[model samples]
Target: MTWLVTGGAGYIGAHVVRALLDEGLEPVVIDDLSSGHRGFVPEGVPFVTASILDGGAVEAAIRDHSVTGVIHLAGFKYAGVSVQRPLHTYQQNVTGMATLLAAMADTGVEQIVFSSSAAVFGAVDVDLVTEDVAKNPTSPYGESKLIGEWLLRDQAVATGLRHTSLRYFNVVGSGSSEVYDTSPHNLFPLVFDALLEGRAPRINGTDYPTPDGTCVRDYIHVADLAAAHVAAARRLEAGQPLEPAYNLGSGDGVSVRQIMDAVARVTGIGFEPELSERRPGDPPRIVASGELAARDLDWAMRHSLDDMVRSAWDARRASTP
Candidate 1:
């Protein structure tokens, strides 16, 4: 039984496809190429250029591929800008998720692993965020993710669907040099772009309550995160019990200053980040405990902050003209 990986040509999705292949599972891909590159789809994989919003197209891909499961990842993921494009965000993430689920139901593909985000929590006033935290999403992007989770839950109750949502903070690092994070809004790419352009990377806030006065957050490597997804899929395939959601996090998160320091050390480019005023509603820290994921899904901080920086730098350099 094969797995259908929606958005499989994107950075995290591409890495997820590799992880599934490494586990001896066949993965078929469907991507709209809006934010994903067609070149990122591996040569041997079956590729369908379509959006999850197109439910008929999604269902056709699943039926054509004889898919038994799915890993849903395609969405408009910019939390900050989502406020300005709330309808678009809902259309892509909320309506798109419903379309995907409807297609899965039609195809009888009940097993799924969703690429959820810590965005669902927004800026929570807590030391360590958990699965049971009162969700108070502040942006359209966050709200869409939370609503997607709710849809999954409702589907599970109504149709006995086997599903799990993986909530992650900041996903970085590449499993292969061929695949890299290309999100224009992400930190690694922004910093890499600045460095490659011969400019210093900038930090948003430097007077928070955390050590070094920089915001702290969990930053998991993409490969490790992908492995957890595969593990969840395996559990579902084996008819074993799985949690509704798991946070793949570094319990004690590294600060932005620490990331800047690591990047400089790893890339051998010595320069301090320029500090600016904190963005509105930016939290001082938003770390989470991955103990549950560690126990069930083989989740761990396998890469250090420096390792993450080095790998990301290598990929960015490799992709440069």
Candidate 2:
């Protein structure tokens, strides 16, 4: 039984691919190389350079690989960019999910692990968001992901297609020495790049209600997130009934100032962040409660904030040509 990982050449997807391999499972990767890098796909894995929006290609890949399960990770992820390109975000995230589901139905692949985001919750009032919180997405990116999760739920009820949607917060840390760096829209990479370039990293807001005044987010290590994916896959393989959406996060909100402090502590880079006015749609606090994932998948985060920063800094330094 082979597993298909859409966007497997991207940052978190690549780490999930590595975890799949470590578990002795064959992972077939499908990435369009738009935001993903071909080099990130591990050697020996059957990789198909294609977009998930292409239903024909997706169906063919699933059929060709005899794919039994899927890890849907391909989608537009930039929250700010999604606001600017709402149509494009809808096309890539919403349409892409529809196309994949159609292809899965055609190929008789019933199980899926969706890469959802904490964006679905948008600006929640709760400090620790659980799975039952009302979904009030603020951006098109978040809406698209919520739509994907809805589609999965609908499909599961209508067609017996069991699926697990893992709602994640800020996914950080590099899983391998060859860093699969993300775009500048993400906070960690953007800060890392600025620090590396001898410039002060920009802190968008420092007057929020959080203790540090900056936005607070649950930043989970990519490796630990990948481990949760493996556990989800194993649960399905064991014929367990599909559970509700699971939150994969640290259950603690790390402030932007705290992150910068960790970076400086880890890498000895004493560059201070330049505080700026709050960007539009910037949430004050969006921490997650991973109680569901922990109870169901038996997942636990092992990396601390310092550990995450150090691993990311190491990867960033090593990637500099």
Candidate 3:
């Protein structure tokens, strides 16, 4: 089966594309290169350089490639920046999703796997977040993701579309040395950048109500995450029933201090992290249980904390110079 991966040139999307190819499925990519690297896309894979907002390009890609399904991952994904640029966020994420869905409907392509985010469940009071948690997004980025999921649900009802959204938290590590997380706002890249520059990495809000006095988050390996996407696609192609959404979490929380420790241990860079005041709206903890995803999508924490840090660091270092 042929699947079109939106933003396939991006870090996570590239990994997903590789996973699809490994599963013996043809993959086509459409990315605007806004935050994606052209080199990240493997050669010989059909690539269309266009935004999902462009209906003509999107429709043509679907028709020309004979795309059987889609893995939607293109959007403005910075939650903090979305607060300052809400309109831009909505335009890129919400409007882009609508356009993609309309293109799918026009082409009679029914199946889609949306790349949703844990940001949908903002500041959860529960220890382990499930699929049914209250979605109180604190930023336009998170709000846009939730609306994207809604678009899939509404399209399913109206056009008999088969779709599922995979909500994940803090994707880290690299499945291959060629692809690495490049987000400026993500913690992994931030810490790595600081270390490379011979500066101390800053840990924000170390006074949170957690065991380590730092915010705790669930981190999942990108390779494991990519595998789940392939599993979801296979199930959908087989006409198997799937939940509306599934959380790809590790079921274990890692504190910022712990991550710093791992980086020091893996990279052999021994330096104290500069602790700073808590950023506004910083939550104490946000971890989820992947029991549902494990049962259905064969999701599991295949990589440990050090393994995640080491792989990401190695990939990042290899990409430098």
**Residue by residue across 1-321, what tens digits does model 1's lDDT show?**
699999899999999899999999999999999999888777899999999999999989998989999999899999988999999999999999999999999989999999999888888998998888888899999999999999999999999998999999899998888899999998999999899888999999889999799999899899899899899989989989999999887999999999898998898898978889998898999999899999999889999888898898898888888
How would the candidate models be sorted by TM-score, starting from the highest?
A: 3, 1, 2
lDDT tens string, model 3, 1-321? 999999999999999999998999999999999999999988989999999999999999999999999998899999999999999999999999999999999999999999999999988899999999999998999999999999999989999999999998899999999999999999999999999999999999877889999999999999999999999999999999999999998887799999999999999999999989998888899999999999999999999999999999999999999
Cα lDDT tens digits, model 2, 93-151, are 99999999999998889999999998898888887898889999999999999999999
Task: State each model's CA lDDT, in order.
Answer: 0.92, 0.89, 0.94
TM-score preference between candidates 2 and 3, better one: 3
Candidate that scores best on lDDT:
3
lDDT value, residue 145 of candidate 1 = 96
For candidate 1, the per-residue lDDT at 154 reads: 100
Clashes of 2: 0
Let me know the TM-score candidate 3 reaches against the reference structure. Answer: 0.99
Clashing residue pairs in candidate 2, if any? Answer: none
Which residues of candidate 1, in runs, are more than 4 Å off? none
Regions of model 2 farther than 4 Å from truth: none
RMSD per prediction, one decimal? 0.8, 1.2, 0.7
Q: Which residue pairs in candidate 3 have backbone atoms (N, alpha carbon, C) closer than 3 angstroms, thus clashing? A: none
Better of 1 and 2 by TM-score: 1
TM-score between candidate 1 and the true structure? 0.98
